[model samples]
Structure formats: structure tokens, C-alpha cells
Target: MVWTLPEPMLAEPVNNPALPPGFAAEPKWDGYRALLARYADGRVVIRSRRGTDMTAAFPEITRAAASLPAGVEFAMDGELIVWEGGRVAFERLQGRLNRTAAGAAGMAAQWPAHYVAFDLLRRNGTDPDLTAQPYTARRTALEELFTDQALAPPWTLCPSTTDPTTAAEWLEWSAVGMEGLVLKNLRGTYRPATRAWRKYRVAHTADAIIGAVSRSLTDPATLLLGRYDPTGRLRYTGRSTVLPRPLATTLPARLSPAGEEHPWTGRTFSATWGAKAALTVVLVVPELVVEVRADVSRDSAGRWRHPVKPVRLRDDLAPADVPLFGDDTTTSLT
Candidate 1:
């Protein structure tokens, strides 16, 4: 039976960790979502969430197909994670993401990726399409397959628990760069391209200077935040999600247009990381410090990998009170 990998199912953000009845929760690994398959004819494919072929970028993972018992074929939904300093390092994975096969091979030795499998899409290359099966059934088959094959290293079975107390404990893993918890209904089917699961991020509040805004100073739609480096340079850190109406109405009184001396006076900000679209922003005085809730996922430079949530204006705090750009003190919350 020939089978093809499908686009991965996605997760929606939830405000809290309380999962509904009959749901199972797993730690949300901070890494790229990828689908892997070992074909019945011995072909192996690794694909990104957007359907980009990533087999060449992760040779070790591709070679992991060899560990499967002869004639055993399977498809898995998982994250590709790399470790550094004894914790999952998302930046290490980014460095090798687009590398050439030879380039990736060299870097793999120092920062090899581990595939953390969360769902089994098919097994034994002969399936009634496991995606159509209930998640509990798929999960049981996945664990059994791992034990039967003695898989190791590049392959890891993601931990899942039906107990709410255990799931809540996993949220503290943010100190080691885990994003948070992903909860899936045990009876839910893996509908491709659908938000079949929900996520609860482990968040920490920190101070950031408002360097720019996406709209008028008085009614800004989004905030472009920054933190001072050791040299006192105001570095563009990350942006917040859209501001609520109340916050938008209250910010104008606190903002002032940037002067020539502003660090980002003429710098352009991308609408999103790696996006070609440029944001039309009004540079503002960087003296206004604000508190934001963000997850532990970050680049090597300590920039937030996901849009932060604006909590409130920190009128009592000064820009200097914020953590420095390279300081992990803010994100290293347990």
C-alpha cells in the first residue's frame, strides 16, 4: 500500500491549561513542525508544515528510516528539535534548516535534530488511514511500534498524559525552552490543515521599550518593542499582537514621535520575521516601557519567536529597568 504524507494538523491558542474531558496533553516542543514517512518501497521523505521538502536538510533523520524493521513503513507527525546547553535550542535548528546537504551534515554532529513524534499517521504501510482514526488509538499504536522496533536517538516518542495535574506540571518546562502544552481530544481525528488541537503557552511578563507603532501614536494597532544591549543600543526585539481597543485608546498620551536621535529613526521593520512585507511604522520615543507576556521560544539573539501579548503600560518603570538584549533572565522562567 502506497501512502503520501499530508500537511500537518495545526493547534489553536487557548488562554488556559484546563483541557476538556477526554483530552490528552503533551508538552509543546519548540521546533519546526514536520511530517516524516518511510515508504513501502524504501523511499523516505521529510516535509515541513507548509509542504516544503526538508529531507536534504536533515540527513540523519532521513537515515533514521533504516532503524525501522524491514518491511515496516510508517508516517509520523512531529517536531524537529535540536539541543544546546542541555535544553532544546530552536536557534540551532534554524541554522541548519536551509543548509545544503553537506553543510547540514557538518553541523549535525554538533547540533543534531531529534524527531519528537506526537502522532502516528500510519503503520506497516498498510493502513485504514490512521488520520481517520481516533487519536487515542493512534497514540497506542505509536508507542507499541517504538517498543517493538527499539527506536532510539533521532527518534523520540513525545510524552502524553490524560491527567490534568501531570499536564500542568509540564508547563514549568519553559525554563528549558519548552513553549507549553498542546491538548488534543482523545476522540479527535487528525484533520489535515485543521486546528485539531489547542495550545496553552507558558508565558512570562517582562519590560520592553516601545520603539515604534503600526499606527498613530495615540491609537497604535501594534507595538514594536526593543531592549537595550550591553552597549546601550536599543535593539529591535519583537512585536506584539494587535492591541485591544482599551489599550489602543490609552497609549496615545504616552507616546511621542521619534526624533533624529532615536535608534530606529530610519530603520525598517518587517511585518513579521522573514516576511518580505515591510511594516509602516511611526518611530516613537523609546522611553515608554511596557510589560508584555511572551513564551520562552526565542532566537540566539533573544528575540521572541512568536508575537507577544501586551499586558499593560508600565508607567512606573523606566526603559533602563528592562532586561538587556542578551540577558536570558526574563525568559528563563521556571
Candidate 2:
């Protein structure tokens, strides 16, 4: 029976690093989540989490998939990453996305992508659907296929370990662009779009200046944060998630309207990257510093890619105490 790829399975956030018994932990790669499939007719497809066809945008991955041995039809779940400066460079991988075929080919020569397969969806036309099978059985099949096919280069088998010590050790791989860990139950089945897996990403707290805010100053929703670069430009670092009721009440007291010289005076902020909706930003004096807990994930410009969790107002800290825009978290987020 021919197997078709399903929507990507999602993972729920987890805080503990301890790997539970009967669960296998894999280092969460800091890159785009993709599903790859090769058909009996020699057709190859690479798709994104949102069901976008990304085959043309990543010629290197497409070429690798097309090169699989005859009759090796399979579908696999994995990440698309690029290695640069001795580590995974997610910004480099972003260069290949949403490009013309020719443009992608050129970028591929400079920053080729690698597919890190972590889950096997199906093996071949004759094999029964693997999504219903337990993770252990599918994982074993995936390993055997890798060994038998002698996959190399663009193809990578993600490391999985059931040992708690090994899983904890993988967390340190954050230095090399690993986000953290995805712990999967051995007896679990692949349920697309379901939070059947647990994810633990590296998180840290840092200080940022409140340059603007969403909603009225008296009842703000989120704080737009910024940090000065070496050139003394207050670059937008990231924004906070919706404030807790108690925290929301405390901010208006400390915040004041921005002066004429505010860095973001004429600028408009988007609700999200590439989003069309503009945020209702109320520019504030860039003096109030706040502590925020953020994941290791960042954008090409060192801005936090996800909304940071506001810990508290760091009244003791000056705007200068925050890390420079180009100083911290040199990575990219999903």
C-alpha cells in the first residue's frame, strides 16, 4: 500500500530534563521541521509543517531524496538544517527558503542543507503503514534502512537515547545549535498535530529595555523590548507575551511616554514576523528594564524569535545593563 505523509506531529513543552524510563530522547535540532517522501514512481517531495511544498526551495534536499536507491520508497519526518562556522546555522538555512529553483540551487552551493531524519513514517510500498506502530518498532526500521542504504551527507540519522544520563548530556549540545530535547514514549504512536511528544528547550533570563507596549499604557498587554547595539542604536530585541494581571497593573506606574528622540518614533511593529496586522504600539521611554525568560532560539539579527515570558520588572537595571543587540543568542527560531 502506498503511504502518504500526514500533518507533522507536535510536541508539548516540558521543563524537566530527566528522561523517563521507556522514553527515548533525541536532541531537538534548531531548524525547519519537514516531512520527506519518495514514491514508487521516483517522485520525491519535501514539505513544511504548514503543508507548504518546499521542494523547489531546497534543491540539495530534493537531490538527495531523488538519489535514493531504486524501489526505496519511504516517508520520513525530520529537520532541514545547514552547517556553517562548525555548527548548525539556521539563518543560512533560511536563505534557501521561498526561493526560485535557480536561486535555491545557487544558495545550495554556498549553504547546502542536511536532512536530519528522526522518525520513520513508512518504509516502502509493501510495508504496512508505520504511523500506527509503536515508536520503537518504527525507530528500529529507520535505523536498519539507514544502514542498509548507506545514506550519507544530506541524510542524517538523529541520535536517540533512552538513558537519562545521555539525554541530559544532549542538553549541553545547545552550544552547537541544538535547541534541546524531544522525549518520545516508546509505546506511543505517531499522531499528527497531537502533542504526543514532550520538548524541553534551553531557556535563560536576561534584561531588555521597554521601548514600547501594546494596548493603552494604563492596561498594557505586551511590552516591546529593545537593546542598544555597539553603534548605540536601540534595536528591537523582542516582545513579551501577554502580561499577567498583576504584572500588567505594575507596568503603567513605571512607564512614561516616549520623548521626541525615541528610536522607534516613526516605526510600526508587526504582531509577528511576516504578519500583516500591525501591533497597537504605544511608545514608551526606553528606560524601564525588565527581566524576561527566553529560549535559546533567536533570529538572524540576534532578536528573540518567540515571545519572551516576563519574569518581573528589573527596576535595579538600567537600559545599559541589557545585552547588546548583537551580543547574545546567535541563532534562529522556527
Candidate 3:
């Protein structure tokens, strides 16, 4: 029987990324979840999490697979990433996805991609299925495979640790694009698309001054948030996700209009760039501060990769207490 692309094993949230004595921790990379396999004839196939056949879409990666350790002619699981400028650039991957064979070669030279492998699923061209093997046994084989190959560029051996302390260290290293941490039970067996494996995603929190409100000030949908620079300029940081009804209803009474001195007095704010969904704001006094939960992927202008959600009303926080990024957390969430 021919081997098919098995569903990637999934992760459930745990408060901590650390594992028990028999478990192990691996750095969760911020990139596409990919399953890769190579043939006896040096042909390779790649598949995305959604099951898209990407063999022709990543020619360079196929070539690199051909160069993997001898006798490693089989299927494996890994994360495909574009590492650049000392960090994994998720945005850079857009250039390589959905491209033809001709286009892939050009993009490969411009923004090369690498596979950070951590799991072994099959050996020798789809024979000897390793899915039923204990994680400990399979992990041992995975490491030995990398050592045998003297793995280099476009083929990275993912770092794994049995020490919780080391996992905590990687969680705080999101500045370099560490997605989070993955914890696997040593005795667990590989079960595709299952939550037998646990994952802890990194989330950061900061205070945002509520500088503006949505169209329905009396019961607004979202809050326009900003932070002050060293020069005390209230620059637009980003917007918040929908506010709870109770909070939204009471916001109008607390906000006062900015007559003329507002920095965003005449500026337009779009919820998303090039997106038809635009929002107009009524600049208010930048007096109220709210706590927001966000991820590390930020825009060139320092806004978050996505709209942040308000953690809660921050009556204890002041504008001075609002931080401007540069904080790391070890906490994990689903």
C-alpha cells in the first residue's frame, strides 16, 4: 500500500510548556505545519496541514530532501520556515506558497525555506511504520538520523529538552520568533490529528491607552488603542477586539472629545490595510488604559499581527504604566 499524508498530530493547551519526568519539550516554530516524504529514487513530496500537495511548489526543499541522511528514504513530520534576519519570518513565506515550478525556483533563491524536523513517521520508502512506536524510541531515531546526515541549511534538527527550565527559556525567546513550546509524553505514540501531544502558545500582555472609540460611541464595537513614545506622541498602536457589552455601554460616559490637539485628529484608521472594513474614530482624551493580550508577530509600524483583545479594564494602570513592547512571558494558552 502506498503511504498517504497523515493528519498532523494536534496539541491541546497546558498552563506550562514543561513536561513530566518522562516527557520532553520542543520549541514550537512559527511557520507552516508540513509533512514531508522522499522516495527511493530521490523524489520528494510535501504536503501542508490542509493536505495541499506542495511538491512542485518547493523545488529547493525537494532537492534538499534528496540530500538527507542515507537510508532516510521515508516520511517525516516538521515545520517549514523561512529563517531570516535572526528570526523566522512568517511573512516571507507568502512569496513561496501557491507558486508554479518556475516561480518556485526564483522564490527559493530570494527567500529560502527550511524544515525544522522533530518527528519520524516512516522508514525506507513507506515500509516499517513507526507511528506505533513509543515517542522515546522514535525521538532517539530522529536525533540519530540528523547526526548521521550532519544536517545543515534547509534541514535543521529541532532542539528538544527534557528540562522544564530549558523549555521556559525557549518560551521567552519569542523575540526570535519562537512560536511557543510543545510537550510530548515519552510513552505516547504518534496519533495523527489527535491531541495526545500538548502545546503551550506564547501570549504577551501590555497596557494600551484608549485614545479613540468606534462609530457607536454610546455602545462601541471596539476600542482604538495607542501608546505614547518617549516624546509623548500618542501614536496609533492598534485596535482592540470587540468589547464586552457591559463595558461598551459605559464607555461613552467616560470619554470626552478632543477639540483640536489630537494627533489623529484628521487621520483615517482602517481595521486592516487594503481591507474594505474601515473604522472612523472620535478622538478622545488618552486617559483610560486597558490591558490587551497579543502575540509577538508585529507590523513594521509596531502594531500587533492581529487585533488584540482587551484582558480587562485597567483601573490600576496609568498611561505611564503602559509599556511599549519588549516583554516576554512563559505562560501558555490554547
Candidate 4:
């Protein structure tokens, strides 16, 4: 009797120490999570992580999936990133996912999102859900099936390497903002929704002396902040978060003016940070000594992205000690 296959399992984070040496690593692309499903009848479906049907939202991609090799059904996992003006416009892809008909159409014409297919969960006459099948076998089958298709939002297979140093270099020099690296064992089989894989993320922090404090926009409280690269010649590297509440109250008087520039924008606003968005306080002083973690790679405007989280105060650190870039002092908490 023939056994049926189940939907492919997704990878989740595991203990950092579980990552053994010699595993292949690839950049974790930042974009929408999608599963491409092609039925035996040639019908295609694109489902979001929430199980929402998105085939209509990405018509061009649907057409592309239909062009895959005949007599095979496939389920592939990947992201849809729209490249515009020499940079990946994640916001444009978000607009498409939100199902704003006008907005999606405009973005599609301006910067269509590309379907980056990476893994094949199902294919040919076989059900890829069999837990015993190895990952290399599935990958090989996927490459052979989709090698000839001309899909819209074109498809690119993400490459992997066993060299951590090379992988680190790729993460640093990635033209598009890369989340990090996914390390997978070559001999491992597909383990759905399990911690069979490991991810090495690139996190950063800068040590800067406390310079000033700013009043929080939503609350009566203030935020203790600091700045790096106080020369005024270099653009703002990024702003540090407030000190702990106990320290924040007494921070104002002890703060010394590090530079002339104010760290806060003096404007109260909220913005998205990584997977979540929150209200943030902006200041323009360099008085506080603190550290911030974030991806500082250049955006479309040539400015670094702001800090996602300010870990803590670094009272022992000095302003001059901060490296402008290429310093990886922040240890991985993962």
C-alpha cells in the first residue's frame, strides 16, 4: 500500500550548542514566509505562515509555480523579497502580503517580489512526508525539477557552505539584509517543526559613554541614553536605550556632555522593530554610557537601522573605545 505524505515541517531554534561543526550554512533571508504547493492537476497554491491563501495576492508567482515540470507536485519553502533601487524593499513585500489591491499592484509594477525557493518538501510521484527520506535527496529532486522553469518574481536557490568563516563573510557582505545563518546537517532528514537545525545570528552592540537623558513620549519618565562616534563627522551610529528605572532617575545629574549633538529627535513616535513594533523615545544627547544591539547595515537612505534593544549600561567602558564597525564584541545569547 502507498503511504500519503504530510506537509513539510518547518525549522525552529534549538540550543546553540547543538550545532555541530561541518554543517552547511546559508543566509536566512528576511521576507514573508510562504509555502508553495503544486498539486498533481497543475493547480498551485501559495499559503502564508498563518495558513491564509495568498495565491491571489501574488498572481505572477502563481503563474511561475504552474510552469514547474509536469507530472510532479511540490511544496517548497522560501521568502518573497522585492528588490528596488538596488536594495531589498521589505516594506513593499509587506504591502503585498497585507492584500491592499492598489498597493500590491503598484508594488508589483514598481518592484515585484521574487520567490526564492530553497527546499522541496514534496515532489514527483513520491510523498516527501516520509520521515526516513534524507534532506539531500529532496534537494536533489527539487533542483532537477525546477531547473528549467521561467517563473515570475524569478527564483534563486539559496546556496550553502560548510565553512563558518565564509558564511560569516557572506553575512557581513550580503547585499541584502540577512537575518543570519542556518546551519543544517548534510545527512539529516527533514524534521517537521522540530529543533533539528541551528541558527547562528549576527547581533551587534556599541559601547558609548552616557551623554544625556530624554523624556519618554508616552510616560512622564525619562530615558538615559548615550552616543558612539561623537566626532560629529560620522552619521549617528545608533542610539542606546534607557538605563534601568532605578538608575534612570539619578542619571541626569551624573551625565556629562559627550558632544554637542543631541541624541534624541525630541519627537515621540512608534516604529516596527524586527518581528514586533513598539513606541520608542528619541533623544539627542551623548551623556549616558550604554550599549545597543541592532543590524547597522546601510538602508536605502545610506543610514544604519536603529537599535532593536538596549541591553544595559556599560559604566566601565569609555567613549573612545568604541569601534566604528567590524567589532563583534556582543556575544550571542542564543
Candidate 5:
């Protein structure tokens, strides 16, 4: 019998993690969405959310899947994450996600990935088209599989609960790099490639210095933000998405350049932090500060994991008021 995996269930965006009653909430892991399967022929495959084969990219995961209890043919859906320092370390994880067999071994040993299964679609070659079944039933099946199989280490059952209170507690986890929460209707069926589930991420707000801009001081597109560390070195935190039209035009006029003492002077900036390509940018004096909406996860270098959203100009607050680190998540400024 030819074994095939079910399509991935995608999530719809929600402004907040509020779920209506009778729904279930799970931690929205900040990692790759993948499906793990074990075939009767002893073949193991780990596929990306887009259905691309990723077996060679994560040899360790394949080895774990192959070690599953013999005679167990199963397919599961979940997130593949690499945890470090008690948080989801996405930047470190990315180094392994796209690597070839030769480069993968090092990453696996350094930051081993964990497969957190959320749903069970197949067991013993049985169909039931778990997609057609309600979420509660599928969730039950997933729990049973974990219990019966005694799944260990690399194989983990994703933490889930129907209680909204418990999920609200998880929202606080964003500060330490937890991605927010995902909510699904108890009766909702898994719809492949459909946004049937809802995801509300934990957004963070903090202040950053305006180190650089997209264009010259005359007109700018986005703000390149930075923060001063304990050593007094200005490091790039992250960039904000394009500003509103008014700010993009008027703010450039207010920025002044640091003729000699500018931290970023003579320093080259990338179009993106990790990318090799450089960007043509007009560096500005780091006196002006602005508040930005950012994600909880940070790269190993202490930069925001994603481009932040510019909230407003903090003209009243001095640059010193801005926290040296962006992970200071307890502030109520928002």
C-alpha cells in the first residue's frame, strides 16, 4: 500500500488570542510547520508545511521516526522547533532547516530539533480521513497515540487545552520568546490549505533608536532601529515596516546626522540582518527614539526576529529612557 500524508492545516490571522467558547487553544510555536510520518516499509519522512520533502534536511528527526515502535504506521501534524536557553530559538533553528546532509549533522548536535505533534491523522493505515472528523475527535486520537506509543524525546505531544484561562497565561510567554496562541473550534474539521484555525501572536512594544532609514534624510521608507548594549555599542535591533505616508515624508526632515561620532558611521548595513546583500542607507544620528511593535522571539544576536511595526514618535522620551535590551517585556507602555 502506498502511503501518503495529509495536507497541512493553515491558520488564519487574528488580532488577539480571544477564542469563542467551545474552542481549544494551543501554543503557537515559533518554528517550522511540518508533518511527520512513519511508513510500514520503515521509511520516515518529515515534510514542510508547504508539502516539500525535508527528510534529508533533518536526519536526526528521520532517525527518531524510524525508531518508532515497529508495526506502527502513522502520520502526524505539528511544529518542528529547536529550543535553547528555555525559549524557542528560531534563528539558530533556521541554520539547520535548509541545510544538506553534510551540514545538518553539526546543527543537529548543536541545537537538536523537537517534533511537537498536535494532531493524529492516521494509525495502522486506517483512514477515517481525520480531516473530516471534528477537532476534538482528532485531538483525542493524538493523545491516545502518544499514551499508547510511549512517545519519547524527539516525539512530543504538543501542549493543548480547551480552557481559555490557561491559554491567556500562555500569552505572557511571549516575553520569553513564546509565539502566542492558536485557537481551533472543537467541532471544526481540518481543512487542508484552508485558514480554518485562528492564530493570535503575542506582540511586543518597546523603544529603539533611529539609526538608519531606507532613503536619504529628505524622504525615507522605513526606520532601521537600534539599541545600545551594556558595552555602549549600538547594535541593530530590527527595522520597522514602511511608515505611514505622513511620517515617511515629514520625519526625515527632523533627523540630523552625526558628523564624526555616529556609531553607524563607516559601518555597512544589510538589506536584512542575516542576508549577504548590502543596502544603500542614509545614516541618522541616534538621538531620536521611536516606539515599535515587535515579536517576542529574538535572534541569537539580540535583534527582533521579524520586522517591527512603527507605533509612534517618542519625542518626549530621551534615548536613555529606551531599555538597553528589547526583551524587557513587562512594560505597560502600549
Candidate 6:
């Protein structure tokens, strides 16, 4: 017997160009990629992104799925996210994914996963065949099926808006750790593994003080500049391409070798730029401040993307007062 499943949804990397006019935009949620399956016998299965059976991993989801109105076999697509402390803790989900039966019971009591159902692919004995239906039609069916409370932990319908300006506003004030806005054609059908949809992302940045410099493991002359947050905590952002050009000769004298080894240096060198070059070693006291831009989004580790671009030095400002954008205040999971 052939089991019905929803067409796989496609995702584009964040921080790209804008979509064409008249596209509907939705918030890119942070959670495990999930495919909800319901058999005619009222059995449900939640599959993970890697095709692992997560039905047993999330008992609450199973219980909830069983409670949904019967006489139907359906498949839904969405993310399994645990909302906590006003943020989506991806690490919490990861912990739950690897738990044993006993461990899952304990973790369930601590952190519960919320199934955010966004699309419906099959309904009852009818093959919705959503690939041929426009997004509006598919979304309407999803809203109708989830209108009742038979499903457990409740499911949130991913809201879609047509206003690009409003969508842009959402991207700007995205405290929920949104990757970006996904724009779908109102009349377009779902296409698996296709880039028919467009994604627009807002990049975030901050001005930080360069606390020190580290030598590049590849390029002897290149220097990796280290910056500090407002709280005086040091973090490596990226290397300075311009710094080596100006102070190439004087770098050796001003540099201080790091005592402890850095984890990033040992890894296979992958360059954001074209060529692979030797790393540099240099350390400076916390003195210089620079503006940096980066694509800020949560990874599987529940941490925002790091090592944004170092824009330029802030000559008029003090290193102690450089502002940090999108700190702990902005979150959507709570």
C-alpha cells in the first residue's frame, strides 16, 4: 500500500535579494523539520528531517495526533519547536530527539514540543494533491482542519501577509529569531525541491571594540581581529583584510601569540573569499572599535550565527560604549 505524504517544502538561504511584487510572506520558524502522518486507523507518526522516526521521541505529539477527529488519513508539514523563556531552544529539541523512553518522559515534563502545522497535503480519503493547489487554498484547508482542539499542545497556523512593507517590518523587528520572510505566489502550487519561491532576509550587525588580534593559521601575514561585546566579553568576529595591507611590516612587532589553542584554526580551512591563505597571529589590547554586519539567525545549536563582517572602525566613539544589536531582549518562542 502506498502511504500518502506531503510534498517536501523547499528552503532558501537567508540574506538574499527581495522577492518580486505580490508574493505572500511568512515567518521562517526555528525548529525541527517535521512531517506529520495520520493513518486511517488513527495512528500518527512524526518524521524528522533526516527520516528518523520521531513519533516515539515526541509522545505528546502522538497523543495529540490520536485525539484529532477521526475517519481521515492526512499528512501535514511544519516544525516541532519547543517554546521556552520567550525563545525557541533548538538544543532542547535536540536533547529530546536523542532521549530514551525513560529520558523522554523526564524531558517532556521539562520541555514540551509544539507542533506548528503549516500545510495540509492529504485529507480524509481525498488526495488533496496540494502540489497543484495554490498556497491560499492549501492554507485554507489547513486552517479548517486545525480549528478544533482535538490535536494536543495545539498547532499554530503560520501567518502570511501580502504587504512587503509589513513583511519588511517583521524582518526588522524579528525578536523571534526569524531567518527571513518566505514569499510564495498566491496562485502557485507547491513544488518539491524547487526554488519557485523567494526568500528575503534582513541582516543584523553591531559595532564592537577590537580587544585583540590572533594569527591566521594559513596566512602568516593575515590577522584575525577579536572583538568584545559591551560586557567586556571577547569574541572573534573575523579577520581584517585591510589591516594586513597597511601594517604588514609592523604586524610582527605589535602581535602577541595566544597561549591557548583556538578550535577554529585546526579545522579544514574554508574561505568565505576565493583563495585559501595562511592564518596570522597578532594580539592587541582592547582599544579599537569597529562596525560589523552579519546574517543573524539561530543554528541547530540554538546560538545566533557568529563572526559577522567587520565594517569599519568607529573613531569618534569609545570602545566601552559600542552597542550590541539583537541581544537577549528579542525573542519569539516565549
Best by TM-score: 5
lDDT of 5 by residue, 1-334 (tens): 7768878888888886776799999988888889888887679988888878888878778998887767878888998888888878787667565677889988888888888899887777356457788999999988988888888888778888887788888888765567888899999988888889998877767889898888778878888888888888888888888898867767977898667677878877778746769888888888899988876768655688688888889999887777785446434321
The window of 10 residues in a row where model 1 has the poorest summed lDDT is 325-334
lDDT tens digits, residue span 1-334, model 4: 2323344455565434233575777677667778888876678888876677788788768777776666667678777776767656565665466657666667677767788876777665645552456667766766775664543347777666777667767666345566667777777877765668676555555454433334542231433333334344333333334445655555555544333355444433333323334444434344345665555343443333444455566677666555543233444342
lDDT for each residue of candidate 3 in 1-334, tens digit (9 for 90 to 100): 4567688888888776556888889988878789998865676889998898887777778888887655566678998888777877776676466677788898888888998899988775334688999988788888877776677778888888898788778877777887688899888999998988888777777678898888765667888888877677888877888887777767778888777888888888876633546677778888898878876665434666567777777889888888653233323342
Which pairs of residues collide in candidate 5? none
Instruction: For residues 40-157, write the lDDT of model 1, one tens digit per residue.
Output: 6668899999998988889889888855656777899999998887778787876566678789998787788999999999887435479889999999989998898888988999
What is the full ranking by lDDT, best candidate first? 1, 2, 5, 3, 6, 4
- The predicted structure with the larger lDDT, 5 or 6, is 5
Each prediction's Cα lDDT score?
0.86, 0.85, 0.78, 0.58, 0.81, 0.62
Q: Which ten residues in a row are the worst by lDDT in model 3?
A: 325-334
Q: How many pairs of residues collide in model 3?
A: 0
Candidate 6 lDDT over 146-211, as tens digits, reads: 764344354667777877667767675445556567778888887765768776665665555553
Clash count, one per candidate: 1, 0, 0, 17, 0, 15
- Candidate RMSDs in order: 3.1, 3.1, 4.1, 5.9, 2.0, 6.5
Candidate 3's TM-score reads 0.79
Measured on C-alpha atoms, candidate 3 has an lDDT of: 0.78
Candidate No. with top lDDT: 1
- Between candidates 2 and 3, which one is better according to TM-score? 2
For model 4, how many clashes? 17
Ordered from best to worst TM-score, the candidate numbers read: 5, 2, 1, 3, 6, 4
Which parts of model 6 have CA positions greater than 4 angstroms off? Answer: 4-7, 13-21, 148-152, 209-255, 259-290, 298-303, 310-319, 324-334
**Deviation from native of the Cα of residue 4 in model 3, angstroms:** 1.4
TM-score of each: 0.86, 0.90, 0.79, 0.69, 0.93, 0.72
Which candidate do you rate higher for lDDT, 1 or 6? 1
